[model samples]
Target: MSTLAPPLRTSWHLKLAVLSASLLFLIILATAFAQPAMRQNVQPYLLDLARTNPDNTVSVIVQKNSKDDASLEKEVNRLGGVVTKDLHIINAFAAELPAGQAVNLSTYPGIKWVSYDAPVQKSLLGGLICTDCVSTTLLSNDYDYSINANKVWNNANNSGAWLQGQNVGVAVVDSGVTNNLDLYSKNALLRSRLVAQVKVNTRASNAYDNFGHGTLVSGIIAGNGTLSLGGYIGVAPQANIIGVKVADDQGLASESDVVSGLQWVNDNRDKYNIKVVNLSMNSTQAQSYLVDPLDAACEILWFNKVTVVVSAGNNGADGKPAVFAPANDPFVITVGATNTYDTATPTDDTIAPFSAFGKDETGGVKPDIVAPGINLISTKPGLAVKLALDHPDHLLEANINYMRVAGTSFAAPQVTAAAALLLQSEPNLTPDQVKYRLKATALAKKAKGSWDTRASLKAYDPATMGAGYLDIYAAVTQKKITDSANQGVPVSKLLWSGDSPVNWSSVNWSSVNWSSVNWSSVNWSSVNWSSVNWSSVNWSGDYWGD
Candidate 1:
């Protein structure tokens, strides 16, 4: 101790002060790092765009806090935004905004996030409010009776009330919607229930179905009995149809064009009362839902309270097909196809061999439900629309205006129509709520039969049948369901940057690791698929076209 006396006697107070200073430095450093993490609102793509060619303009979808649409548009204008499409449903805007401005937009007041217009990247840390929250069914023949749409319209409880989806609009975002007699408005106040029509991806003059797919999709959702005299009444016949043409005369469209079409739909949804969007198309790309632009688009739509319905693709029972884009997205309802075998019961029904199944790249199961796809007939243009021209034999001898088509494309609109009916029945239901109700009420196909026979149940495989087959009657009339469909679920955009899929258990759902992301990995290039880029390689080119 005597020898150590020379070694400057360090006091306990000095040690305490050193420790305190170290902690204070750490706290300040952490605060500096934490601030940006708190607002990881700029999409990686927008960041890249800002870094490279900052002056270049690209269409981006922006999510902001500002409630005023006019003011928001003005802000966008101030930032050199052009062709700005108000996607108010998601509290966003689709504009050709300058790259630098789009990236820096996150710092602006009310600006939450900004991403390339493929779909989007929305902040995970906010409460949702449906921007324009406004919110049934019957059918005939194989799907009509099979899906129980007929019973829904003429049900004993709903009897004369006729829940035919009054005022609800189903936007058919496809080739275009040809005006058929069945699609005409029966009301005196309105000229047509085909509420809005606009050309999306094409230079076509009008948004009428020269390609035929949109009309068929629309008819499946809301065709009346003008031609068949109630014999071929559609599901939710009284529902409004908002036709958006994203394809050319040859039934081809670019993904950008399709996105623009959706932009149009979102902009005008309030005007047309469009709540349900029927995307009867599939993406050819196998990109993870985490990065797929289409997935981004559908996600924003779902958040904005629009019920998005997509086809599961026609890749067939392959080696676990990566369920195509919007369909692979967990938020929207993805539909698969089932062959009714010309019967009205599920005992004889089998999953269509050509219908795509999935365990998406993100490990999410796909095709939320199945519906009649094989030999399903709906409104087709009498003139040589692409589908009709491609398969002349499918034209019904009884009615040339109706054509039988098969694929998940036809199956998606059925669910869209059901959603319309559900909205009509319960106007205040959110998209997540709608998803929950549809899934909760959907009857699980029994091991030996449908829900009609309360027998031994089958182990559900979400890849094949999703929750179960579409049962519109049960979905509409079921007890009130309040749970959110996405509760404790993984969102597509929050994926980890590495090759490995995100471990949802360990992730902080409220924050994003923006630094690790490389948005250049996202493929926005458009290549000719011999048809529309929205159609899958095997889907529209071969199987779906059949």
Candidate 2:
């Protein structure tokens, strides 16, 4: 009995020692893994800027590990930073701090990351040629038929309902959308279609479009052709507009204003049923989409189910890579411009000379789709009428409140309006699904005579045209089932990765064979541009150009 007791006691002692060792091993492993989390929370640019100007106060985004406001405020105070605003929606705070102090805040226990609030400028180019056509007549333009928008409106489904983009809301985040006579009328349906207009900038008391850009974009999306008497209708005439005025009177907007506008849209998505957002402007500063704050803000909105459409910029003539921020981001639909040549048939369509194109910084193919933007006549601001009339050579047609304009800015809204029609047909479709559907159903560019021969000595490339022109009827009526779960980078992975100050160098490059985008089947030499009328061609306009 004594021997048995000794053995039992020894066995219990050995079990206790093994349990303690196992617990100690787990503690060591956890500590080793967690040590990397304390290294640095500030982006490299912020650090460099701080070193150069330690005392300069700059706006920053502060992400905290704790949710308690008091704790966050205390931390900010301790770090010599002033809390400018609390963005609780993103679990972060907007603070203004001395550059050096802001960088130091990254060392705090509860801090996650500190990012400089980058500035975002509007990208617009002004160039136009007046069409000699009479104002009293209704001309059939090529863009509507080029994209097949007219067919979508005329076709009847099993339910006898035409895809007119009813009940869908598209948020235009840009210069204020004015109450143009073409946009708003005595018709209750038209009046209510403007839905909600919010001024995000404190500098403006009213939400009127002082800069003519936003009104034109809105008119292109949902203007009900009241002024033209159904001759110049927009792509989705019945879709509602949720105008988010981020840009000021000078057509300038900062990153914060855009972010605030996006946040408001996210919060009020249900109130307005905003399923699509048209970002017709581009940032001058180019950055990797993985680390760009504007791209991050756009991704958040996209993940929440808002279809974001951005202009690919009008920087094509500069010889620099034209794709720039938020458009450079893969998640959003980056649109380029195609000249429909003011005709209904797409046989003469060509890639716009001024429209930007290229692979994004992350190597993603951009300008996911192209649309008719050259000499588009849409609703213009009250002030632009005199400007258009003064420059008769640039005016295509000037009605009481409408003017003709051209830019990649105008091209983006065409896709946005089409997205509204798609959502109206399938409200449950995810943002990824919408993107895939548009790309899959697009009309392949004709290899011959598809581009202006005078501007280029070589053949047209797919890099400029993406998946070709926007095909609204094909995108809406086709019954193809797609699972976009694996396409591009998932927004969820970007949002929840917890890898703040994203190391862009480490991003896994897409293995997609970009060479596969080449169009070798068509004869390029047979194309002749001499048949196209050069006099009526509007070369006077450029998109987002200097």
Encode model 2's per-residue lDDT on 1-546: one tens digit a residue. Answer: 000001112466598766665465345333422454434456555767876776688888776655664576666665556898876644577888777666566656676557677543222223222121111112233476668776675344212236767788899887777765556532453456788889897776677777666777898898767665444678887778888888676666666677678878878888999999988877665556655556666876775688899888888865555677778888899998887654454545788888888896556677898898886777766745333445445433224456667788899999999999998988888888899888877777342222212222122357887777788887877646454522546332234344232333355434332222111211222322232222111211235321
Give per-residue CA lDDT, model 1, range 419-522, as digits (tens).
99989988888888898888776657453223344322243455588777777887776644566676555555533333533455665643433233332222
* The best candidate in terms of lDDT: 1
TM-score of every model? Answer: 0.64, 0.62
Global lDDT scores for all candidate models:
0.66, 0.66
After superposing candidate 1, which stretches have Cα over 4 Å from the reference?
1-140, 155-159, 186-190, 317-319, 445-462, 490-546
- The number of clashing residue pairs in each candidate reads 4, 8
Query: How well does candidate 2 score on lDDT at residue 147?
Result: 83
Candidate 2 stretches with Cα past 4 Å from truth are 1-139, 157-161, 184-190, 384-398, 445-460, 485-546
RMSD in order of candidates: 28.4, 28.2
246: Cα error in model 2, Å: 0.6
Q: How many backbone clashes does candidate 2 have?
A: 8
Clashing pairs in 1: 65-110, 119-297, 136-420, 136-421
